[model samples]
Target: MSVAHLIGKAGKPYTVEVEKCHIRQFAQAIGDTNPLYSDEEFAKKTVHGGIIAPPTFPIAMSEESDEDLDLGLEYSRMLHGEQRFIYTRPIRPGDVLTCQLKVTDVYEREGKNGTMEFIVMDTEMTDAAGAHVVTSRTNIIYRSVSANA
Candidate 1:
């Protein structure tokens, strides 16, 4: 099945709620020991005035923020090609974040095995106050079934 052609030109947007516990777990999973992320008291002294999440904490909310594409891509053949995040301001606990996402680009490259599909997704995260908190660019490379054989 040609799953690539099924994905429409425009992608869907999604929203997610950010919580303090989520931030703490993400910090722990990433082995980040920063006081700003781990200690509420220490964070209170900083400019943010509260517990602040690490730069990559936004990823933890991806599952909630991602659209249900159901593209039929084989999970075993999928690979994380690239990821980048640009932050306008630090993310603090208790901030309700909403993400707007769209497929910026989609293309295929022919290889000896078959064709490799590249999907690029652009995501913008904003706080409840409408402040842009972060912009994330994610690239996913889907290897053809033939390539995995």
Candidate 2:
């Protein structure tokens, strides 16, 4: 299969509601002991004024990709290759967020065994006021049986 042919030309946007419980749960799951993510008093002393989420907390707030979209890749064959987030501002509790994600690139390369498909997604996260909060890039590598020994 040609990866270039599988690229999703357009992207669908999704929204997520940020709540204190969600943030707390996510922080606990990652074993993050940061006071900003848990201690309300400690967080209130910070510039954020009240409890603030951890830098990586947005990942937990994101919704899954739309299943109705023709993403063109088998979920079982996909492997998370890498992920990065650039933050413009801190995320505080009760802040509703929206994310717009699009397939930035898709390509296939010959590997030692055969071929591997690479997919890149670019996501822009904004607050309710439409202020850009963060940008995240996710990469996935799909390796078929022919692409691995």
Which predicted model would earn the best TM-score? Answer: 2
Model 1's lDDT to the true fold? 0.77
Residue by residue across 80-108, what tens digits does model 1's lDDT show? 99999989988877778887666777788
Q: Which regions in candidate 2 have their CA more than 4 angstroms from the true location?
A: 6-8, 64-68
Give the CA lDDT, 0 to 100, for residue 70 in model 1. 60
Give the local distance difference test score of model 2. 0.78
Question: What digit string (tens of lDDT, one per residue) describes model 2 on residues 15-117?
Answer: 7777888888888998988888878999889888888887777666545545434676777778999888888988878777788777788878787767888
Instruction: Provide the clashing-pair count of each candidate structure.
Output: 0, 0
lDDT of each: 0.77, 0.78
